[model samples]
Target chain A: MIEILLSFSQATGIYSFMNSPWGWPVAESIHFFGLCLLVGTVGLFDLRMMGFAKEISLADLHRLVPAGVAGYSLNVVTGIMFLSTAPDQYIYNPAVQSKFFFMLIAGINMVFFYATTANEVKSGDAISRVLFRAKAIAAISLACWCAVIICGRLITYYRPPYHWCLWC
Target chain B: MPGSKLGLLKLETLARLEETALSTWMRESGFAFFSALTVHSLAMAFVVGINFAIALRLVGFAPRLEIAALSRFYSLHWYAAVFIFISGMALLLAYPAKALTNPVFYLKLAALTLGLLISRHFQATFFDRPKVTNDRRTINLAYVSVLLWVVTLTAGRFLAYTHNTLLASRYF
Candidate 1:
């Protein structure tokens, strides 16, 4: 996995750019900006479903979700830059592993929401306080994203992580 | 004193601040420093995120979203803003000279202040009004708010790379 990612970066010039002094911090800035965008949009939608900002129409708020998708795309691009550029450092780190785990949960939760609850919640079509399921999904989604952020911070502190990491 | 001397004097004071029991604990304790940094990031995301959402609306993304109702999120934004300051202060306490001696830190402070002021203006103007209109000036302010926030984030990231004095206590 590391070899393939390195080769891809080398071919794409991502290796050269990321190796530069400014590259890492620049990427960090963009990564954070993207996160804020996601939190502001998709997270806001989640909050509304959880019943904050009750006056705002769910369908109207749904429009901002595209911006959230855009933010998520930015994060993925920058994330690959970080991961591919230094696979050894991140791949073996337990914090990075936990971050990925939360991201996966958030992703799955999003899919499940759209599949089961989005339509009724958005259109107000037969919506109920039994939209309890929707609220639960929203809470889980928010918690997962928050957990992901915390884990991202922990990665810096846990360098060359200890033996608890099975591969480490 | 000349400008350079005054600057040096300020840094000397900050260096002593870093040596205090509280500052020492904040810097040396992994849990303390780590908590401050993490809370700062979390609060920042919410504050910046909410600001971005409002700016987008002003520039016409969600045309039907009543700007009045949208400003309600400002309550959350304000709450997060307070955390940003509290966490920010803890971070500065941890590395007094590191932040105070760096010009980039001041730039971030300035940009963030301006961004919040813009948010305050928007909230005060639109929140109570049943009808809201984004005039040309208001739209321009929104654009400027976005730029200010980008500057704040960039300047913040650059602080780690650009600081020339990590511990002014060397001279102290």
Candidate 2:
């Protein structure tokens, strides 16, 4: 795993850029802005699915999903850049590992949501059954995303236990 | 006295607050500080996230959605705001000098205040005045609200990076 990460980092040229005075700070700022966009849109949609804002049509609320996707895309790009810059810092960090775990759960939950619950809600078939399913999925989505954010913040506090070998 | 008269007064007040048992406990207790940080971050996400949804609606992203329907979220927004405010105060008490001395801190506070005001103003406008159309003015306010949130979040993040003083005693 370390060897793969080392090779990947070597292949990328973002290190020098990330090491620049403005690069990391600017990237961090963008990362946070993207976080707000993602959480705000996606989280609100999940709340709606869970029957928070019942007055707003599910279809209309789903329209905001695209903005959430954009935010997620921005974070993924920035996240990869950060990894490319310093693979060792994240690869061996427990917090990063947990963050990835939560993200994977969120991704799977999202797929499940779109496959079953979203369709059920959109088609207006078996409203009660779909509402129950949607509520469960929404709860899971919210929990996973919140966990992801918490773990992401914890990364800075928990570093890799081992010393870095640049040539490893 | 070398600085502004108000600066001295503020420093003295902060110093006294820092010596209080509550402040000391908030600072020295590991769990308390960590919990407060977590609450602050989570609350920020909710407040910013809910506000973003409303702002996006106002910007005409979801024209089918009624403004009145979206107003249902304002209560959630306010709830999160209250949590953020309480957690934020705990954090400030923990390190009053760190935040009080930073310009970015003031910027974050200003942005938050303005963002909340804009949100309240628009909510009232949308709910109270039934005839107000989703015109350019409404959209403009939405744009401004989002901008202010961006500023507020950025400023809050920069506070960690930009602080030069951790306590009033050391600096003053």
Candidate 3:
């Protein structure tokens, strides 16, 4: 699977663009901005779900989630650019793998939130059972996202000792 | 002392700060610098993230949301800001000359100051109100705040690429 992904990335022309003087730095800036958007909107919504700001209606808070989703989309685009530019750096790095793992967990947590707890909270009155579940999902989502950030930061520190392949 | 003289003296003091034991420890200690960097990045996410949410709300991204209610995040923002400030200081102390000499460093500081001021202004004008009026001025302030925060993040990132000197006392 890694081999296939590596080959697919190397086949793209983004490598030269990414290797350009301004490419990486510009992408990094956008990546950080996207992170702020994701964490700010989605994370705030999660906090509300966990009963942090009870006065605000959950429906109102949910309005911010689309912005968070937009941030996630931005990151996905930049992240693919990064991966295509240097597939080996990410493919072989344990830190990147860990980041993917955390992202997967966060994705699952999101699904759980939407599928199960979202409706209960949307009613604007958090019953005890729904509140407990919401709190648990919220905590998990926060932790997973935090781990994803930490692991992403650690990727450079844990670069794989491998030569770059032109076409994999 | 004249203004320029005072500036030189302050730079001299900052240069000396690099030679302090704490600064030396921060630089030489294994993992300490890295840990501080991690903390700084994480805290930054929270600070920038919450601020972005607030900015979006002000600009009418979520029209149904009450601006006053969003002020609940003010405490979290401050907490993250405090964390970022301390960790950032550790980073600066570790290489005072590197940051102090870099033009980008000053830009980052300036941007951060402007961002903070905008944040305070938001708190006073919008958050403190019982009902936030989504006027043009409020939206403009929100737009400016978001732009300043993005500038702060970009300048901060560029600091790594733009610094020329590692230690001011030895070089200067």
Candidate 4:
């Protein structure tokens, strides 16, 4: 897996750019900027559903989801850049593993929301059960994303023993 | 005081801060230092995220969305802002010289302060008027606010790199 990622990165020139003097920090900055965008948009949408800011229409706020999608795309690109640049440093890191785990949960939560509660929740007032489900989904999504952010920070700040896996 | 003399005086004070129990503990204890750093990042993301949303709105992303109602998110924004302050002060206390002596740190401070002041301006205007519409001035302010936030985030990232002195007490 590491070889494949490195080969792909080298083939795509991402490795060279990331190895350059300013490349890593630049990518890190953009990676974070993308996250802020996601939090601002999709995260805000979640807050709306979870009964925080009750003023904005759900359908209207959904207009900003495209921007959140765009932000997620940016993070994926930069994330790939980082992963492919140094697979060895990241792949074994438990913090990175935890970060990926949170992202996976968030992804599943999003698809589930869109598949199940999205329509009912977005169409103004919904049945009580649907509202409850939507709130649960929103809370899960927010928690997952927050956990992802914490894991990302931990990747830089701490490198635990036997970091190849979390339980070890 | 002479310029070099003043510089030395500042360094002397910073060195004293570095030797303090709290600062020493924060630096030595990974849990304390990294927890503060993580909270700082979390708070920064929320604050910047909310600001970006507001800026996008004012720049005409959601044309019909009520600006006043949207400003309700300001409640969350300010709460996150307070976390930024507490975490930020903790970070600064840990390494007083690392941030204080850096010019980039000052740039970040200026940008963040101006960006937040713009947040206040938006919240005040939108809440006061029932049907406030975006004008040329408002749109321009939105653009400026966006730019200021960009500078603030970028400068924050660069602060790690641009610091000339990591610990002032080393020289003292």
Candidate 5:
């Protein structure tokens, strides 16, 4: 099934992007820039909630959230381009699998923040508590993202066999 | 082993440690080593980038907030940096020979050191003094810190292109 999908992708000339001399590098550069902008904006907001930049009210700090969201959006779009170009190669790869799983956990972590912490943030009295949860989420996000990058790098080394080969 | 043998072993180690894309490409250890390197670079952007941004705000360039409120951001920055360091160490272990011998790696270490030192100074000098807002010195330092981090990151990427051994030798 995985091979069939990969062949279809290949037949479509999807992976041809890798053939371009500048394609991979350009994608990688953009990916990195997105990471910086994402961290910068979200991190600023988190710092505000934590009382590091206490002068800035939550409402003011909240402005930076959109920038972070934009960064995330860039990553999502570019990330898809990377994965689509090589389906089986990534789907069966262990490192990619691990990265995807961790990313899901990170996503869920964000959901918890939105579901539970969002109200506390609006209430205004719980800046300290909100800060704690925000920090936790930020930290986890960073870790999972790091894992994702590592796994992505490992794709070459952990190239999936076209078929499962059992050995003892 | 005698002095000559000791020298030979050290030479061999240096040769092995040389940073070359081909060496990285052809390393026999399988996926673990390379994966760690990719993770390290990714983690670096987050940790360093976030830290620099917060420091800039605290220094007064982004004057919208009181310097003290950025603490949460700083804490997250530190955590991200630490994660990168741990994973970075794992990467280093996988290719101790190459990393230790590579000049570019040394450059990265130096840049990180200098960057961190400036960050510490900014934290102590400006951040501690709540009254000190919009100081020119702080802003200047913030600019320098950001530049240093960019250099560090770029140098890290260029390691694939610049390492002497990659061009000089081939890996099988």
Candidate 6:
């Protein structure tokens, strides 16, 4: 199984990426920029939710949410590029696996926010006391994103020794 | 013994530190060390990025902020931090001995630890304070938090060159 996985990893389509001079560094730089934008947009919004700026309209603050979304989207596109170039390295890697899962959880957590809090938020009641669910969603979202970063960091450590694990 | 030859040799004697079993395993597994290195560095943006947001808010970069409104982005920031940390650990595992012996690595860890502690304290104290105004204490903490992250990241970057245990005989 390891042999097959290694073979696949060394295959032409994937290996071509490593051969490309601009490929690796470009992916890296873009990933970093995306991270910064994501952090700038979403991180600021999260700080707002945590009561940093009471005078700022929540409605107005929502404007930054798309930037966070854009960051996530950019990461996804660049991330896919890296993954396509090195599928086995990431697929079998435990860190990558956990990152994928946490990312999924983070995504669902976002949906939950939109589903449960969108209405109240839209009504301008998001800052009120009855918004317990929204708060809960916020807390969960923070935790999930943290988990995603941790898992993503560990991906290099968790690569499966061989591709045969794919069958399992 | 104070003036012994070995004492003089201590300055010149360089002991090799070999790569650990885990690191060797990672290298053999075909992961590109260069790519992993870049990713690990990139992950910091997430960790420090969200942190900077929170810190800046505390320091008055954005006034009149709402805790409720901030919670949304905070969650995503947490996600980004966690992803970065996990990847960092993996990179560390890829070179455990080097990292373990590197003073810079320990420095980064200590800074991160302190930064988190202070951040949590700020959240508990100020996030729910009666007013949204930025107090001196909050501003101080914000500055300190940013300093810690910056130091931590710089130290992390320097670890590659400062490692005293890379390719040492212990693991080789």
lDDT of every predicted structure (CA atoms) = 0.88, 0.82, 0.82, 0.87, 0.63, 0.62
Worst 10 residues of 3 chain A by lDDT: A159-168
- Which sections of candidate 5 miss by over 4 Å? A1-23, A40-61, A84-88, A91-94, A101-116, A126-157, A162-168, B1-13, B16-46, B55-63, B71-107, B161-172
> Taking the tens digit of each residue's C-alpha lDDT, what string does model 6 give over A1-168?
445544554674544664476556555555545665566656554555555555556666665566567768878876876676666677777667777877788789788777767668646755566366666666666666656655665665566775234334
Docking class of 5: acceptable
Cα error of candidate 3 at position B160, Å: 1.4
Q: Model 1: which docking level applies? A: medium
lDDT of 2 by residue, B54-137 (tens): 898888788887778778888888998999999999999999988988989999999999999998987787764435568888
TM-score for candidate 4:
0.94
Which parts of model 6 are misplaced by more than 4 Å?
A1-17, A50-56, A127-130, A162-167, B1-43, B50-172
Proportion of native contacts found in each model? 0.79, 0.68, 0.69, 0.71, 0.49, 0.21
All models, DockQ values?
Answer: 0.64, 0.54, 0.50, 0.58, 0.27, 0.12
Deviation from native of the Cα of residue B18 in model 2, angstroms: 2.5
Q: Write the per-residue lDDT of candidate 4 for residues A33-53, one digit (tens) a residue.
A: 999999999999999999987
- Encode model 5's per-residue lDDT on A1-168: one tens digit a residue: 555655654776645764566555556655665667666776555544544655557665655566567767877766765677666566777767777787798788778878988667745776675668866765776566656666556666666674332220
TM-score of each: 0.95, 0.89, 0.89, 0.94, 0.64, 0.52
Q: Kindly list the per-residue Cα lDDT of model 4 for residues B1-172, writing each as its tens digit.
A: 3259899899889989999999888878888888998899888999999888888999999776677877889988999999999999998998998999998899999999999999999999996465888999999999999899889888888887778887633211
CA lDDT of B145 in candidate 1?
95
User: How many angstroms is residue A98 displaced in model 5 relative to the true structure, after the best TM-score fit?
Assistant: 4.5
Model 5 RMSD, rounded to 1 decimal? 7.1
User: How well is each residue in B1-172 modelled by candidate 6, as lDDT tens digits?
Assistant: 2258873344223221124555555545544554555556555666677666566566654455554345344445556667567778776666665676567788989998898787566566644444556678778878998788767755664665566555432221
* True lDDT of residue A76, candidate 3: 96
Error of 3 at A113 (Å): 1.0
Q: Can you write out model 3's per-residue Cα lDDT over B103-163, one digit (the tens) per residue?
A: 8898889888888888887777766575658789878888988998899988887787777
- lDDT tens string, model 2, A1-168? 656655665667566667776677767777877777888888888888888977777887788889888988888978987887777788777888888889999999999988877877865564787788888998999999999888887787677675332333
Model 1, range B1-172, lDDT digits (tens) per residue?
3158888798778878988999988888888889998999999989999999989999999898878887889999999999999999998998888887788999999999999999999999999685878999999999999999999999988998998778733211
